[model samples]
Target: MDPTGTVAIRARLAQAAAVIVTITMLAGTADLALTDVFVGGEGGHAVYRIPSIIRTTSGRLLAFAEARGSQSDNGSNDVVVRSSDDAGTTWGAMRTVCDEPGRSLNNPCAVNLTSGPHAGRILLMFQSYPTGKGEGSVATGFDGPYTCRTLVMHSDDRGETWSTPRDVSRQVKRPAPVTSVATGPGIGIQLVSGSHAGRVVMPFNEGPAGKWRVYAAYSDDGGDEWKLGEPAPEDNAGHGNEVQMAERADGSLLLVARQFGGGGRRKSAVSTDGGASWSTLQAVPDLVDPSCMGGLIATSSVGAPCLVCTGPASAKDRTNGQAWISTDGGATWPRALPIYPGSFAYSVPVVLSDSRVGILFERDSTSKISFITLELPSNAAPAAKTP
Candidate 1:
């Protein structure tokens, strides 16, 4: 059906239901219509940075970022968060999630653990730096005296209150003085079929080369006693800066990575034996990323596992960001649609259960963040053209 016809049918249906219920259905519809459409950063602060967004099982949209302080050196950055109960229509006032005494926190990644022991918990992973220090110069890749630690903060009752930050870095035996390039607990996923089934898997980067690695730590009896898994193969020298893993329909796991080295292209590797043994690094054709972090989601929609990744379309820059879809696992991807034309840094795209796409990315070079929601075109086909 045509777009106009679809809109008219939906409106008529809503109105008819309102009349049947004898309530102000039309008014509610009008209010929804008046809700500010998702225009990216239309109503957000002008100077937000390092934005991360996630959707809850109840459909609440939560966005978190580092609200930069004044230029005159005001101590540290503030970790702020906002929520949208009605999809992406409107957002509540920004609230400080973490205000450290003498430290700065940034690069927030959140996940709603729907399975395992902590089923309804919301886990937030971010990096914390010591007092009076900015995230180390990118040239050094966070190798400095400031000391950055990976922390996990969780909320059991939604966003109302959070448990004290739990240091997961202890799981990894760090060298004396702890100066060997440990920066992030960036993104986490739940393992489905591995020996460490139901364990929380977090992908982090270390060393000047930024060799990205995946660490598995499971809390068998809730978040009380946690065990760490051995390092998986195929992560040597590859900067797993922003790692994403998804369990395929066949119970296998597919891990996607963005290379931080030169060329800025996306790479993929498969773990048939549940992340223990992985295939060699192979380039994912048609997906280009400029060493920037992107988001990936695996869903069982078309009778098979479908994957979606949002990253740069340009070969050498992160200015042109696009969304690519894969149908036959991660073997190949073909469909590419532009999400933003100009330079947007490290946008994370999330797929909701209803198939809608939510992306939060940096607007310009000025540390501003924008949020956008798109209803993916149903007629769009996967680039692989298989499943």
Candidate 2:
């Protein structure tokens, strides 16, 4: 009697243990809610890095990144994109947006024109490098194949197809002391108010490697032509690099950039003339950056004026991905919530259809590009509207 009873007790205990293990497994994965939009080493590439994302007017999400031949930035790289119909819940196949045989096309900056004849058209701006060349090797000039070139392409059908790449280097690039120029590795903005309303503004950075500076390349008649703005005034504190822009409620533009020499804090500047010229660069004290590309955008919801930025929270390393919210038109980032606590680099944030902020970022060591959605605080500011 005792033997049979003891055997039955052991069986019950074994069942209980299995149930506990199952619960633990579910618990571990319950909070891992990120979607891998572009995985590393997929689609005939060695790595996928420098993510840029946007939500089209047709209610589709497009994520773009650099598909590289090797992990190095100087290698052969192509700009690729993937679209999602259900708002990042699912993704379509990877489509190569732009590719140059033996050359490298990087920084897939995208923006959707919200007004005028090309209101729904999407424009992508990127920098084309010479064969196997990178930022350090490229020189500043208008020469087609020897110097770096800035190009643009458009898609009217919500990223289904792209037009031929047009060279805008002569229009958007500065002549001297600028050895290399790169487009917003994130996204651009279209002005909605004031004298410059409906202007498509693209953020760009010119570099001699260490002394990088930020500026804007804008088009008023839609994406047909582009013009360069004066570079942000540089100082001893920091030099701007890899930047993004947001429109304020008062119709001004705010640009946030990565600080090259100054290390810890993000650099910011403002433009009242629709990015024609920018104010002096200032450090965003609250946005602790590690010299990596960050995402900045104005929320498109209905409430107060809100701006959201995504990047690493650490000042020393590219870890701790977090969302910094500013209710006062990016005047101050008082609220921050963690997106990922480890290994986040080069992120692009977009406003989703359900009023959530979606951040597409590169994981540690330039491995993959992933997407995660974060909810805005209930008391946070709403969308900004020009007066």
Candidate 3:
């Protein structure tokens, strides 16, 4: 009648516009696969950066960083480590917990003593720093021995093999005028609670780069000996550097420095008695970071005693890497959880036994070294089998 019914009505409007554009082009989308566990030139090093993940009471999942042979964070660094008994997916090769070849041990901090008599061995501090022309020019010397020192090593069948460096740096490096003293680009905590239960803390920082600040170094007979506390007080936002710690439930202690020239976010403090003294600096602008380096622990059981933290929530750079929990401990972090979006600077969470929460970062451009695994935000806190 009308030319075959108008050609079957334009072929049913061209198959209803191709099924409405393939159902809105397949709708929702998501794909984020990461696993670069440190690969900037690989195996032999070239540039690794600072990251520090831990979780060994026998459970295993120790990871560290700062391999660098030349990417310039200072120079010829070392302090590599690896191990993952099936947590971060896979990782086992890279060792070198601290190579002092020409000097530049880097900043790798570890801790897993657990209880009293060194509950399970594994305490790796670092900071050899000093290359070529005496690098930071400590006081005015070259050779070796001291010039920004702070070494300490040990591993009892967990980190595999390590135990050579042990220069208390005169207890824990005092006499500040600043030149170097970095133990812990991340990872270190043992105090169980109150009265400094068991103690083993570690979270340090000195100066010579931008006038950094932040101090802490405990032991109480566990890691043998490791004094040095009191220095993290002045933090309106001007100095303080790459620090991180967590020991609270009642014991007292909570550091989280990394504020550079006094920008704004990320400064935290509070040591009731554990870290000796620390109370001034408090900014935590919601865990932002252009100032980089973050990773504070203390997750207790599963809820209440919370205080996570991973970096690059971004205030200016490193992109958006998240996972900032905190439940009234650091005062407020509310519940973030982004983990990798662009570059993601330094990070280190570790609280997994089963509760889940491993975040070992420094990805996007620092060559490699990445990890993720979180689950905390069902209202923001509640679950305590052990964190």
Candidate 4:
């Protein structure tokens, strides 16, 4: 106890053996395991609607859905497909990428535009409807001439096989009684720069005053001519349906919307000259929900421009899903965590290339759609790093 108290007890036993070897190597890399990738249909109460997961370039984890056989958002629907090689643990059954025999394929958005001329193809946009005789009144839902369209299907391989829903809204200029009421299956993005650089943008909720539009169709020489373009900044109240578009590493285009009245406020718009023109629909402070849909990535992580939003901050609590991180790109979003509290989740959070952060949401409350794999803490420090 003399030599300076035995060198302070050997520096507190080497800082407690470096905190027990850094908590046993983070408990063996957090046992990296997360596997639950269900996609329903076997007459088990059809309710696999509104799923859109994408990760391809050969890494494969594609999911595009709308397989209603029951949970009726309006009878018969189809468009479905699923895949996962190992990343999502396991999934390979469901597959029916658009079976229109009563038309009703909803909400799907995928992109893998290699570059202009459909450079590698893997583009799929969805929204189709036809087959009715009643229960259609949003002022006659476009006054019945029945033929709702918004399709653009293509796959140069990754999705295994596909290519036939090609009526990209046929230069949308509807006015008269050309009604079949359009409501999308909306979400698509691929236009890193101007002059339609590899264009393929789908954003929906069009007819019957459901306004909130964003429709641009272009496939230079790939999906065989899909022209339509002109409605990026048209006047539509902020009630925009479940639209989510993203591409912002300066090649600006952010569009994030969701608001069906009753205080689930989440709205954003910015197109710095890409989706035509937009920027006036703010209010994304804490991101509530109106049937949440989240997936946005504009990352350089901390070097600058960062944005990552994964559904449900609390729309009066649907089990409280979370994942909202912004580094001053979407104009401030301090930091929020909580992956999935209890059940009802609707995630989209994706950021892979080894950076790790993959979330494919929807769970419990019987919605069932999961594939969560998030393990952050490479040295953990980005809550704006304090002490």
Q: How accurate is candidate 3 locally (lDDT)?
A: 0.71
**Across residues 324-345, which tens digit of lDDT does each residue of candidate 4 receive?**
6676667766564445545654
> Which scores greater on TM-score, model 2 or model 3?
2
TM-score of each: 0.74, 0.88, 0.32, 0.29
Predicted candidate 2, C-alpha RMSD: 9.5
Sort order, lDDT high to low:
2, 3, 4, 1
Error of 1 at 381 (Å): 6.4
Among all candidates shown, the one with the greatest TM-score = 2
lDDT per residue for candidate 2 within 240-297, as digits (tens), equals 9999999998999999999887758898989999998989998887888888999998
Q: Residue by residue across 1-387, what tens digits does model 3's lDDT show? A: 011111111112222121111100021221223456787887877789887778888788988888887878657688888888877666777877777776777778888887898689888887776664232566422234557777788888888888888878777766646667787688888887677788888888876667667878787888897788878778455877889878766678878887886664778888888886788877766666677778888875354678777777656788656667776777777565455656777878888754567788877677787776655534532211110
CA RMSD (A), model 3: 20.9
Colliding residue pairs in candidate 1: 212-240, 334-383, 335-383
Name the regions of candidate 4 deviating beyond 4 angstroms: 1-48, 51-67, 70-75, 78-99, 102-107, 110-124, 127-186, 190-198, 201-245, 252-294, 297-304, 311-320, 324-335, 344-363, 366-387
What TM-score does candidate 1 reach? 0.74
**Which ten contiguous residues of candidate 3 have the minimum total lDDT?**
16-25
Can you list the residue pairs that collide in candidate 4?
107-185
Local accuracy of candidate 1 as per-residue lDDT tens digits, 1-387: 111211111222232121111111111211112121122333343346666677776778777766555421124656677887866656776777887777767667676776777887888876666656543332232334456665678888767678888766555324342232332223456666556566555444444334444333435443545454444454344445556666665666666666766345666667665544456665565567677767777764334468777766666666755677778777767654445555766666666556567677664453456655544544453332110
By TM-score, the candidates rank as: 2, 1, 3, 4
Error of 4 at 93 (Å): 33
Cα shift from native, residue 274, model 3 (Å):
18
Off by over 4 Å in 1: 1-46, 70-75, 132-146, 172-186, 191-197, 209-238, 272-279, 301-304, 381-387
